[model samples]
Target: MAQRLPSAAVLVLHGGRETGAVPPPPGPLNLPGVRMLPFVRAVRRAAGAPDGDVLVRRVRYAHRGWNGGRADPLHDAVTALDALREEAGDVPVVLLGHSMGARAALRAAGHPLVRGVVGLAPWCPPGDPVTQLAGRDVVLLHGNRDRTTSPQATQSLTARARRAGARTCMVTVRGGDHAMIRRAPAWHRLTAGLVAGLLGTRSLPGPVDEALRLPPTAEATLGTLDLDRLGARPHGGPAPAGRR
Candidate 1:
């Protein structure tokens, strides 16, 4: 009999600016469905159900603003993770976060039940070095043309993670801006490939390899289009007719 595929749980946390109640733009950096629903869909497709067993369980939390107050968003995230672990019943867990949420995922890495963490466009705020990541597998994905959070920030964090003894790799998407990845098929492909690899699924080229390439100017202009106009609310709900 074939060995059963190990169950995997995935938790996604969204990032937002500290001041605003409305939340920030969703893009490659944040996977805000308004901005990157296509990429999210691609990732879901890539993390296919394992043969005779479910390979993935997904959970998402999108904070309206930065949890700079007494209630630590990180702690809340850990609590949610613990709940997910209990619900999963011994399945391996993978934590995925973008931007500020990535910071929370990094802090949650030391949890005994977690198998790995993926940080997309992670930004490390000033704090004690992330010592919890030691011995865990981590993948950091960032766009080279990202202006919101520079690649340098990710490089520095990766270096710090390495020094803390974490097994980590940083993948840079070329000619890709923070939000451009959502429009370019390559972004979906890269993300799907990464998730599939982690899930031990058969490797396949992402849709980007065959998608049309937009020039830098056009790519930048794509950001001007308000994703909120796409008819979906921030976390996958229907938008109010007049709101978008």
Candidate 2:
């Protein structure tokens, strides 16, 4: 078969509930709390994205969560990425996912075509692989007020990725929750900026506020510790052995 020429592609993955069942498709309006629609639109309309140059696609999961079972979210992500590569040729892909989807994007970052990954409130537990993402640009955004997935998980994951030689950065949203509905504007700005930066379309705004750079008040109190002691584990297969 004739191969499609390479072009840029942005793959969006959405966070799932703990049900382990398929999620309803996102509505067209991109409403608040809609799995991943808001984020997908944010990136698509980001500043500096050239028309006809970038393709944004969202992954539909067959089941919720990364339970390490057959046809799980992670499995669906891989399948989506594989199809994307086939259709787009050897194009550079920027992955953006939230929560469980974020975890799946991080796990899938090892792919050669993946240029960068943007994880929003990712559920990155200890022991996830960082070596696979060596030398790749990785950005993580988490809300300080998030209870569903702690920002510490992303912090640990970022520390490990740094150790593994991946260029990594983490941003914390003040008073933002798991859904980021509280600081919706901030969430959209950060996500859009990260996507633009990752795709090399434009650089992220600098001279940011101190609060955005630091984690939540409570987590910040516990001075930095050794990440190696955090039980960093890398799964041998497509997904993590345990669910968050």
Candidate 3:
């Protein structure tokens, strides 16, 4: 019921094959679950954002892989992003993608509408160029134990992006695998935190807010709202010695 300034948009892209879209004749069951909806919902709920302040779009690719010639996932994503930009009217857009989609998001990060990118277990091959990501804030989260797409690939990608003048950080998900099914909570927490930080929205409930230890840019509203009761010292408050 309130109007917020500096509106933002989030585009969520899912992994390949396992999360690809169905044919023209579709039903409700056709929804993408492999990684798309879950991530979008988590970030949306965490932000608790009202309409017009933050908008989210779940991208359904034309094909499963980025290599699909005419049906390339990247092309579909770019078209979706263009539509999103037109709808939001120049609002800052944050791209959130997993696996193959993650790689595509990184490639499209150079779009003027995009300000930040969050890649979950992205499939970034060693030789993947990073020039397209220049000037964008990038965060890559990969399961150290991921066999589907080596964590090393994301590490190398981060390194190259940083070298290309992008503010980049790669977070290793300890003992987790590519899907991150076991440590889903932590994965979602980090994703939601990043979304809140970029969109200037409220952080979700529970200990995750304090656990994230997000910067003021992300936690300012949370701090003012006293949402971080688990860690009162986060808002420039006095901390008693020996307090845990």
Candidate 4:
């Protein structure tokens, strides 16, 4: 069988509820999925996948929410990965998700195809399961003032994730909101830089790279990285040798 040719793949996931039913026949639209359009665009432009080597796709979910123990979104993510693996041959994949979608991505990162996961304003509640993320690159960005999702909860999870043997880093978005409306460009830029770095298309911003390199110490786990200080370049040309 002839293998498909994208060198790398990125699945941009959207956010949804903790528990909710997706209406039949789409009476209500998949607004959660719709919210990720800009992210898809930003990644496409920023990833700079050489010769279009990176195939960026948005995973569509059968259900709108996580649906409690059923973990509806997780099933959908894995299904998407299964299909991606079938179509793209043996390329490494990066999972980028927002809020509820972030939770699903984190849960699904254990898939063989996934290299890492980036969560934006994720819903990493207590005991969300860190074992699935072992040996994976986990990057989380949460707004300090987000009322909908607790930033501290994600920080706690990152701390645990670091201990669990995952290369982890969390950025505290100051003055930002849950929806990423405030400081939107910063969120998008940071996300793009992180994804590009994960995809091996560009070098990671200094602070992020340093944070990830830091040993899983108490200070590193509890500490935060500055978004601006990370030197988030809008257009990173290309990655050098031995960059992950």
Candidate topping TM-score: 4
After TM-score superposition, what is the CA distance of residue 222 in candidate 3 from its true location, in Å? Answer: 28
Predicted structure 2: lDDT:
0.67
Give the Å error, residue 20, model 2.
Answer: 0.9
RMSD of each candidate relative to the true structure: 12.7, 10.4, 8.7, 2.4
Report the Cα lDDT for residue 243, model 2: 17
Best by lDDT: 4
* Candidate 4 Cα outliers beyond 4 Å, as residue runs: 1-4, 23-28, 49-51, 220-223, 232-235
Deviation in Å, model 3, residue 62 alpha carbon: 0.9
Which residue pairs show backbone clashes in model 2? 127-232, 127-233, 127-234
Number of clashing residue pairs, candidate 1: 3
lDDT by residue (72-145, candidate 4, tens digit) is 98998999999999888778999999998899899999999999999999999797898888888989999988
Clashes of each: 3, 3, 0, 0
For model 2, the stretches where C-alpha displacement exceeds 4 angstroms are 1-6, 22-35, 47-50, 69-71, 207-244
Task: List, residue by residue over 37-153, the lDDT tens digit for candidate 3.
Answer: 667787787655445467877786666556533436677778988987666578888899888778888888888888878888898877767898877777777787898987777
- Lowest lDDT sum, 10 consecutive residues, model 3, at 219-228
Off by over 4 Å in 3: 1-6, 18-34, 68-71, 202-244
> How do the residues 73-115 of candidate 2 rate in per-residue lDDT, one tens digit apiece?
6677778889987787788888898888888888888887888
Q: Pairing residues by index, what is the TM-score of model 3?
A: 0.74
Clashing pairs in 3: none
